[model samples]
Target: MQIIQSLSEISGRYRALFVDLWGCVHDGVHPFPGAVEALKAYRATGGKVVLVTNSPRPRDGVAEQIAGIGVPADAYDAIATSGDSARLAMYQGAVGTRVWHMGYADESDDGFFTPPAILDDPLAIERVPLERAEGIVCTGPADPYADPSEMRPQFLAAKTRGLKLLCANPDIVVDRGGRREWCAGAYAQLYTEMGGESLYFGKPHPPIYDLARRRLAAIADVGDASILAIGDGPQTDAAGAMGEDLDLLFISGGLGAEETGTAIGGSPDPARLERYLAETGVAPTYVIGTLR
Candidate 1:
C-alpha cells in the first residue's frame, strides 16, 4: 500500500469521488473532522463528490442523517444509498414484492415498508407472516445495540420457510459512535448458511455501484479512471472498488483496522498494514491514516 498522510496529495487526480459514510466520513454519531474537511477541500478543487454508502436508507433519508450529524451539504454533490437500489429492485419486482421485513423500526429501514417514489406497477409491500411471505427484506438488526446472535431465531425461521433474502446493507458490522455493532449482512450470512438464497444491494455488490455511478454521471462526465473510491472497510470498500474497476483510497480505521494493528481513529503502522494487505490479497490505489 502507498501510505499517504493526506488526501490532498492525490485528490486532484480524480474528477469524481465515491466516498463512504459510516466509518470513513463519520462514525454514525458525529462527522470526522478530517473527513468533513477533506470532502470540502476536494469539492473546492472542482471534484464532484458522491456520498456512496451502504446505509439502508433512501438518499433523502441518509442526507437527513448527514445533516443531523453536522456534515454540510457542500461536502457532497450527490448521495447514493443501498436503500435507493434496494427500493428500485423491489419496485421492479427483481426480488418479489411481498416481503417479511426483518429490521428495526428506524427510519433507515423505511424503504421496505414505504414507497416514496411512484411505481410503474403499484403493488402493496404487505408485511405478512414469515411462512406466508414470498421473500424477506433485511435492513438490519431490530435493536441498535444488539448482536448478530440475537437474530438467529428469526433468521432460522425465515430460512425454514424457504424465503429468499434481499439484504439492503451488506455491511456485516459497523463502528457506530465508536461502538461496534452488527448489521444486516451478518444475519443474511446466517440465512445463506441455512440454504436460503440472498441478494445483497450494497458495497461489494454491483447494484449499489451502478446506482452510485448514475449519480456521479449526472454531475460530471467522468469514467472509471477519473473516479476514486474512499472508505474504511476492506471487504466492502476495497472489494467494491476492485469489482467496479475503480481506484481506491483505503482509510486505516474501522472494522479491518485491528488486522493491521491500527487503532480506530489513530495513525497506521505501514509495516503491519503491509502484512495484513498481503494476507487478505486486497490492494488499494492509496492508503491514508484518515481522510485528511
Candidate 2:
C-alpha cells in the first residue's frame, strides 16, 4: 500500500538529505514556500542537508546566488556543482592550457583572471581552431550549431585536430522557460555516438553522485533507500534520483512548467498533470504540486 505525508514527515525518515538546488529548494524566481522553514527545522532537529545542483556554475557561485535569493549558506552542509566537475576534469590535465569552452560562458571565467583559454565561439572549430586546444569543454546548444548532418563539419574540425570533449553538464535536456532545450549534452551524446570519447559529469551520472556522497559522508550518511530527493524535472532530477538509487518527490511547477496554466483553484488541473506525465514518461515516488 502507498502512503502520503507532509514535508516534515517526508524528511523525517532520513538523517542526511541530498536536495536538488533549483527546483526542490527554490524556484528560479524565488524561494518555495515551506522550503526554508522545513530546512531550518530539519537541521535544528539534527538532520543533514546538502544542496546538489547542476547549474553549470561553480559551487561558491551557486552559494552566492542562493544567498542572494535567501537560502542560508548554513542551511546546507555542502555544495557540488557541474562547473566544479568541469574544473576537476581540467585539473586532471596539465596546467596552462587552452580549453575551448563550447557552452554557456559565465562571467566568472573571465573576471578574476584567465583560466584555460575559455572561448564561447561555436564556430571556433573553423575560425580559431581546436587543433592546438589542450581539451574541448562542450556545454552549448547544438541545434543552433546546425542540423545533426552538419555535426561533422562543426566538431570534426576539432576531432580532425584530435581534441577531447569534456562535458560539463551531462544533462541531455533542460527546461528553459517551459520548453526542453538541447544543451551541450546533446552534442556530447552525438560525439560518443560517432565513436568519439567524452567525460560526463552532473545528473544521471556517477561522478556527481560520488562527489555528493563523499561530502554527505562527513556530515551524515543515511541509507540510500531512506533518503528522499525532491525535484521538479524528470529527465534530470527524477532520472537522477533513480540513477543514484534514492526516493523521489516530484514538484509540478518548475521544470514541469507546461502544466502551470488552467489552474484548478490555483494549481495545475489533473488533466494537465496527466498530459505532462504522458509527455515526459517521468514516474516519481511522490507527486506534489508544491512544497507547502
**Alpha-carbon local distance difference test for all models:** 0.82, 0.65
Per-model TM-score, in order, reads 0.93, 0.76
lDDT of 1 at 260: 71
Which candidate ranks first by TM-score, i.e. highest?
Answer: 1
Quantify how close model 1 is to the true structure by its C-alpha RMSD in Å: 1.9
Highest lDDT scorer: 1
Runs in model 2 lying further than 4 Å from the true structure: 1-5, 94-98, 110-129, 139-153, 160-162, 172-183, 189-196, 259-275
lDDT value, candidate 1, whole model? 0.82
Q: What is the per-residue lDDT of model 2 for residues 3-36, given as tens digits with 9 covering 90 to 100?
A: 2334676776777766776666775556767777
Please write out the lDDT profile of model 1 over residues 1-292, one tens digit for every residue. 5888888999888898999998888888988878889889989889999999998888988888889999989999999888888877776665576778778755455445567465666566777777677888888877857766766687787777777888888998898787888888888887888787888899989988898888888778999899999987877888999989999998876566777766645667878888877876679989887777
Least well predicted 10-residue stretch by lDDT in candidate 2: 119-128
